[model samples]
Target: MIHLTLIIVDFLTGLLAAGAWALASAGGAIAAVVGSGILGVSLFRRWRRRD
Candidate 1:
């Protein structure tokens, strides 16, 4: 019983670690996309005005 419990705990810990990493990466990607969009829009407006 103790062995089974240890295995389960390890499995859960690993899953939690993986989930955390994925979440962080996803958040970073989303932030980058949003930042790029904002930058693109601003640049477009600036160029339009110059033209």
Candidate 2:
């Protein structure tokens, strides 16, 4: 009985860890996209001003 409880706890912990990792990955992807967009806009403005 105790072993079964432990196994269930372990499984739950692993599931939560996986969810946290997925959230972190998604956040990083969003940050990268926003950063790239900002960089692109800045470069565009600089190039336009030069002309």
In order, candidate lDDTs are: 1.00, 1.00
Q: How much lDDT does candidate 1 score?
A: 1.00
My TM-score estimates for the predictions, one after another, are 0.86, 0.93
Please, what are the lDDT tens digits per residue for candidate 2 over residues 1-51? Answer: 999999999999999999999999999999999999999999999999999
Report the number of clashing residue pairs per model.
0, 0
Give the per-residue lDDT digits (tens) of candidate 1, residues 8-49: 999999999999999999999999999999999999999999
Candidate 2: 10-residue stretch with minimal lDDT: 1-10
Q: Give the TM-score of candidate 1.
A: 0.86
Candidate 2 error regions (>4 Å): none
